[model samples]
Target: MTASGLPMPGGTGGERELLEQWLDLHRATLAAKCEGLSDEQLRRTSAPPSGLTLLGLVRHLADVERHWFRRMWRDEDSAPLYCTETDRALGFVVTEADTGAEALAVWRREVDRARKAAAERALDEVAVHPRRTDWQTSLRWMYLHMIGEYARHNGHADLLRERIDGATGF
Candidate 1:
C-alpha cells in the first residue's frame, strides 16, 4: 500500500477486460507522473506563471471522470466529484494538503462511482447531456469519452513528469 493505506489492486480482470485495460493504463500513467517525487514536488506549479501540477492533474481527471460518467451520462444526482460552479479552477490549484494519498483517494472513489454507473446499464443505454442543447449519449459513448480523455491527459502527464524530475516513458 506504499504506506498510504490504499491497497494497490493488482491485475485488471473485472467487468469488461478491455475497459479494465484502459483504466489500468491510465492509473499507472498517473502514478508514473508522480513517481519518485515528494508532496512538494508533486504540488509545485510547472510554469512560473501557470498553475498546473502533477497533483492537480490527478485531481482534475478524477473530477472529469466523475462529471461525465457519473453526473452527466449516468444522470446521477450525487454531488460533483470535486469542484463546482463555485470553484472552477480547483483542479489546477494544489494546496499543501493535496498529498498523493488524498489525490489517489479521490481518483479511486470517483473511478468506483463511474464503474457503478457504467455497470448499471447496457452500452446502448442513452442519457441526455447536461450541456448540449440537443444531445444524447450512450453508456458506451461515455465510456469511450472517459478512456480517451484520460489517454490524452496521460500524454500531457508524460511531458509534465519529465519536466518535474527528469522522469519519462510510461
Candidate 2:
C-alpha cells in the first residue's frame, strides 16, 4: 500500500501487465490527491491566476483517455468530453456547480474503456496518429506516452493537492 492508502503496483509482471499496473497506480495516485476534499476544494485553483484544479485534472484526463484509446487507437469517431473547437480549456475551468463525484466517475469510465480497448490488441499493433495522419505508432508507444502523460499531470495534481490542504505523497 502507498502512503495514500492505495495499493501500489507490483514490481513483477510482463511488459503489458506492468505497464497497465503502473498506469493504474498513477490513476489511484490522482484519486488519492482528491481524497477527503470537498467539491469546492476539488474545484479550487492552485492560485489566483491559474485555473488548474484537481477536478479539472480529472476531467481533462478523462477526455485524454477517451481520445487516445477509443478515438486514436480504436479509430472511433468520438468527440471531446469537455473541450470543444472554440474552447479547449473547458476541462481545466471548473465551476462551483461541478461535482467531484461526477468527474471521478467519468474519469473511471474512460479508464475502463481505455483498458478494454488496449486489451483487445497486441502491443505491436500500429495505429495512425489522429493529427499526424502520415505517422503511425505502436500500442506500446501509446502506453508509454500515456504513462508519461499521467506522470506529468500527476505532478501538477500533487502540487494542487498540496496547495489545497497540504496532503502530499506518492
Candidate 3:
C-alpha cells in the first residue's frame, strides 16, 4: 500500500487480474486526491478558466462507470446519474447543493456495480454499445477503455488537487 493506504498495483498477475488491479489503483488514486479536503475545497475549481473540480471528477466518473458497465455491458436501463442530453457534461457541473460526501458515495456505488457487472464475464465476450448501435465492444476493450479513462481523469484530479492545496505526489 502507498501512504494513502490504497492497495498497490500488482507486479505480476494474469491479464484480467492485472487490468483489474490497475483500474482499482487508478480509482483509489482519484479517491486519495480528495483526502483531507472539505466540501468547499472539493468544489473549488483548478483555475478560473477551467471549471474542473475534484467533486466534479468524482461525479463524472460515477456516470462513466454506470454508462460503460451497466448501460452498455449489462444492457441495463440505468439512466445517467447526472448527465442529460441538454447538459451532457452535467456531472462535471457541481452546484451549491453538491457535497463531496454524497458524490463519493455515488461514485463508490457505481464502481461496485461495475465490478459486479464484469465479474463473471470473459474478456472476449462482446456487447453492443448502447449509444452506438452498430458498434460492438468486448469486455477486454471495456476494461482497457475504463483504465485509460481513469488514468486521464486522474491526471486532471492531480492538477486539481495541487491547485486546491500544496498536496502532490502519488
Candidate 4:
C-alpha cells in the first residue's frame, strides 16, 4: 500500500501490465487525495491566483481519458464531457452545483472506456493523433504519456490537498 493507503503497483510484471498497474495506482492516488473532503472543499483552489482544485483535476482528467482513448484511439465520434469550444477551460471552473460525486462518476466512466479501448488493440498498434491528424503514435506512447501526466498532476494534488487541510501523502 502507498502512504495514502491505496494499493501500490506491483514490482514485477510485463510491460503492458506494469504500465496499466502504474496508471491505476496513479488514478487511485488522485481519488485518495479527494477522500474525506466535502464538495465545497473539493472545489477550493490551491492558491489565490490559481484555479486548480481536486474536483477540477478530476473533470479535466476525465476529458483527457475520453479524448485519448475513445475519440483518438478508437476513432469514436465523441465530444468533450465538460468543456465547450468557446470555453476550453471550463473543467477547471466549478460552479455552485458541481459536486465532487458527479465529477468522480464522470471520471470513472471515462476510465472504464479507456481501459476497454486499450484492451481492444495491441500496445504496438498505432493510433492517429487527435490534433495532428497526419501524425500517428503507438498505444505504448499514449500509456506512458498518461502516466507522466497523472504523476505530474498528482504532485499538484498532493500540495492542493495539503493546503486544503494539512493532509499529505502519496
Candidate 5:
C-alpha cells in the first residue's frame, strides 16, 4: 500500500498486475487527447458523442473528482461547483469559448479536493450518502470505484479523439 493504503499503481515491485495495468491504460487514454495540441485543438469536437471535446473531458473529470471525493465524501451540503453550475444536461459539451488552459485549471482544482478528502479519511472509513439514502461506502471502495469510472470514460475519450484526428491512442 502506498500513501493511500490501497496498493500502489504498479505494486511495490513496480510490476503492474491486471487491474493496475487496465487503469493505467485508461489514464493514458484520457491524458492523450490533450497532447500535441494547443487550446484550440483540444476544444474541437465533431459529431455524435454530443461534440464533447478533450477540454470538456478535463471539465467532466474535474466534476467527477469533486462529485466522488469532495462533495460526496467531505461536504455533501455543498453544491458541485463545476457540474451543476455549468450546463447540467451537457457537462461534456465543448463550447467555442472554452480553452484548454481553463479546463486544466478546473481539473486541477477538483483533483486538489479529491486529494484533500482522501487525506481526511481512511481506507475503511464509511461515508454516508446524503442523496442516496441507502448507500454508504468505505473510502477504499470509493477510490477503486472512482478509478474504474475514469478508466471507462477514458475509453470513450480515446474513441472520440481518434475519430477527431486519426491520431490514435492515449
Candidate 6:
C-alpha cells in the first residue's frame, strides 16, 4: 500500500476481492487527498463561482455511500445527513459549522456501514431500487458504480488539493 493506503489490486484475486480492493483504493485515495490540509484549506473552493470544497466532497461522498449501501442495499429507512428535502445538493454546500474532521469522520462511518452491508450479500444478490421499486440492482453493479463515483470525485479532489497547496501526484 502507498501513502493513501492504496493497495494494488492483486492479479489473482477473485472478482469480489478485486472490486472491493479497487473500491477501497479509491476511497483511500480520496482520504489521502484531504490529508495534511488545515480546516481553511479543506474548505477552500478550487475556482471562482464554485462552492466545491474538499470537505464538501467528503460530506457528499458520505451521503452517496449511505444511499447505496445502507438505504438501497440494506433497505434501511434513512434520511440524508447533509442534504435537505428541497436542496439535494446541500452536502456540497459547506456551512460555518462544518469541519473537515467532522466530515471525514462521517465519511469513514458511512464507508464502514457500506462495507458491512456489502459483506452480508453476494455480488449477484439483487437489491430493490430505493426510489423505484420496480427496478432492482445487484451488489456487483453497486460496487462498480461506487468505484466509478470515487474515481470521478477523487479527480476533483486532486485538483482541489493541488490548487490548495501546489501538491500533486498523491
* Candidate 5: segments with Cα more than 4 A from true spot: 1-8, 12-29, 85-88
The deviation in Å at residue 73 for candidate 5 is 2.3
lDDT of 5 by residue, 61-87 (tens): 777777778867786565665467546
The TM-scores, one per candidate, come to 0.79, 0.93, 0.96, 0.94, 0.75, 0.95
Among all candidates shown, the one with the greatest TM-score: 3
Where does model 1 exceed 4 Å of error? 1-16, 131-133
Query: Once superposed on the true structure, which residue ranges of model 3 sit more than 4 Å away at CA?
Result: none
Weakest 10 consecutive residues of candidate 2 by summed lDDT? 1-10
Give one digit per residue, the lDDT tens place, for model 3 in 125-164.
Answer: 9999877899999999999999999999999999998888
Most accurate candidate by lDDT: 3
What TM-score does candidate 6 get on C-alpha atoms?
A: 0.95
Our tally of clashes for model 4 stands at 0
lDDT assessment of candidate 2 = 0.88
Q: Give the alpha carbon lDDT tens digit for every residue of 80-99 in model 4.
A: 99887567688778887999
- Please list the Cα RMSD from the true structure of every candidate, rounded to 1 decimal place: 4.9, 1.5, 1.1, 1.3, 5.6, 1.3
All candidates in order of TM-score, best leading: 3, 6, 4, 2, 1, 5
Give the alpha-carbon lDDT of every model. 0.73, 0.88, 0.91, 0.90, 0.67, 0.90
Clashing residue pairs in candidate 4 (N, C-alpha, C atoms within 3 angstroms): none
Whole-model alpha-carbon lDDT for candidate 5: 0.67
lDDT of 6 by residue, 1-170 (tens): 66635676777879999999999989888988999888999999989888899999999999999999999878899788998656879999987778999999999999999999999999999988877899899999999999999999999999999999988776
Name the candidate, 2 or 4, with the larger lDDT value: 4
| lDDT of model 2 at position 160 | 94
User: What TM-score does candidate 2 get on C-alpha atoms?
Assistant: 0.93
